[model samples]
Target: MIELNPLVELIIMNFAVGLIVTISLNIEVGYLRIPQFGRLLAVIVGAVIAAAVPGRILALYLGLPYGAEYADHMYNAKIVIQINNFLSKNLLLSLAVFILTLVLAALAGGVIGYLCAYPALRLKGSYLGITLLTFGEIVTSIAWNYQPLVGGTAGVYMVNPFAFVGSGSSSLAALITLTIAISIYIYAEILARSPFVRMLKAIRDSEVASEVYGKNIVKARAQTLVIGGAIAAVAGALWATYTGRMNVASYTRLTWTFWPWAFMMLGGVGNNLGILVGVLLFTLARTAIIQYKYVITSVIPIAAEWLEYILVGLVIIFVVMFKPQGLMPEKPTLTLPRKAIEEIRKRVEQEQGRL
Candidate 1:
């Protein structure tokens, strides 16, 4: 068996997380046309849950209190050690807790999505986008200042679910993340081929027409946001498990929001295949920039951190200017059978003739 380098493993994990996030974004902005600029909202909810919930569960199982006192450095270290020791002795329980965290995270995200839609129902275009974005910022601010929430600025170290795997924890985490990413991609592809996706596209293309055809536009948008938000939260849960830590700073607007949007736009809006391609390209670029930052900075006048922003901005600008539809322009969605479609077309023509 070949041993993989730690850095390579980390890169693979990042790519998997990125893939999950970008695909969820695609479903909202690409297919449903929700323009969910507050992508970090769902993600942060997941991370916060992961940071707090699992630890509380473990503390309860061990008959200990769950709070900042328990989450402090010395206390947290001891708790993690005890948890790992218990997990090592109880494999099934460990797996169960891990699964439970994911479920809770997804549920929380879905509920938040539904609530967000109420404010969004009365807004459209840039107004809707700004509202969502502001909501995310407000949540982040609360998380950062409120000590009860993930220890506030101090953040909290999470108990790794894969601790039982011992030395292979990193590899196991990468494997799990990759597996989830692939599963979601397949699921999204299946959804893309379904009639439901066509409804979402219809909503995106023409809300008035879809309404005329008796479709509940608001309901459709809400459903899409709920589903997308749930999936995106799964990414955050995975990230928390992978890193074994949670911080508000880590789930930033740039990392969780703008970057995934960039991936969605670059890959080709509404194109799943394009999303995959865009994720790969951007992930690779990001990994390379991070890995070679010091070397690159030595030759360039600007700082390494700013260089990444500059390059990403340039890519977005170039893509928008030259290929606005993205690398793979969205294809027409054909949900109805040929016969049914023809009948509908004939009926439409007859109605037009009367007019």
Candidate 2:
């Protein structure tokens, strides 16, 4: 029986983490009218802080505040007791540090989101895209040399990847992670269905008009940005812990952030299910290419490494030219019928703000 090696399996596992973080951020930035690209920093920052904190070990021991039962089932182990035994000395302090790190990451994301509010005042679409891309690059570069901040290019280390201990089966972990990732997508779908997020689309379509109708654009934008930032940070912590590494080199420009944008765009901006399909499809494509590199090169006389960006760029071009709505257009819940569409049309006509 031909089976993939553990290393290959682990890489695939981590890719699942990347997909979740990327898609979660897409919900906020791509769909929710808050174009935030500096969020890649939140993930790394979360990972670094989570790794260095001793309390993560403690959280395992003391157990999560209320999710102990579910954690036990999900982990299929007594994680708290295991973690407690491992970090026997000063377990409370260690747990405290871990929890504190989570809070800090959340707050950091919110603050950065708030910072971008000013720039987002008159920005949307391409103008916002350029600013966000620059922010992502600048923050990523800081991760490169800001050694004192994130342990420099070497990054941080020895982070726990799971909410519990002994939960590292590559296949099972990937499946579980994928399920949670889908859950987040489901939540994003709910947000999209709600009128609250409709206001966001309004802002995306026309900020001036949304404000003209008494919507607090700044608050709405800031709320979305902060929510997206925090979600990305949670993913970051997961990524760091999964690898047991936290060096800038580990989470730099090459891997963490850019690909999510590609996945999000390819999937369809403002579409949750599309994001999932995009992540799954793109990941499968990348894996297939890597797995068949020898045959691919033999047939085409090309290097796999050199073709990385080239392939991705070509894929993006294809997305722009065709399937512009992505594999799944932002779906309408329960599939709106023609009558419902006409009703919506009338409502929109009656009061564009109402619909």
In lDDT terms, which candidate is top? 1
Report the error of model 2 at residue 276, Å: 0.6
True-structure lDDT of candidate 2? 0.63
Tens-digit lDDT string for candidate 1 (1-355):
2335888887789889999999989988988778789999999988888878888888887987676666565577677777777886777888888889899999988988888889778988899999999988999999888876677777788877777777788688788789989999999999998888988888878889989999998888788889888998899999988887777788799989999988888989999889889988988888888888889988986678887898789888988999998888888865579899999999999999999
What clash pairs does model 1 have?
A: none
Clashing pairs in 2: 54-94, 55-94, 55-95, 60-80, 61-80, 147-152, 154-247, 155-246, 155-247, 156-246
Candidate 1 residue-wise lDDT at 332: 86
Q: Write the per-residue lDDT of candidate 2 for residues 1-355, one digit (tens) a residue.
A: 2334765665556556666676667757665656555556667656655554443434444654223232223331344345544543544554455456657766776676667677776786678867866776777687667654445555434433232333343344345555655666677767778877888877777878988999987898878877777767767765554555566666654466677877877887777667777877777777777778898899889987667678788877888798777676665445578999999898888897666
* Best candidate (score: TM-score): 1
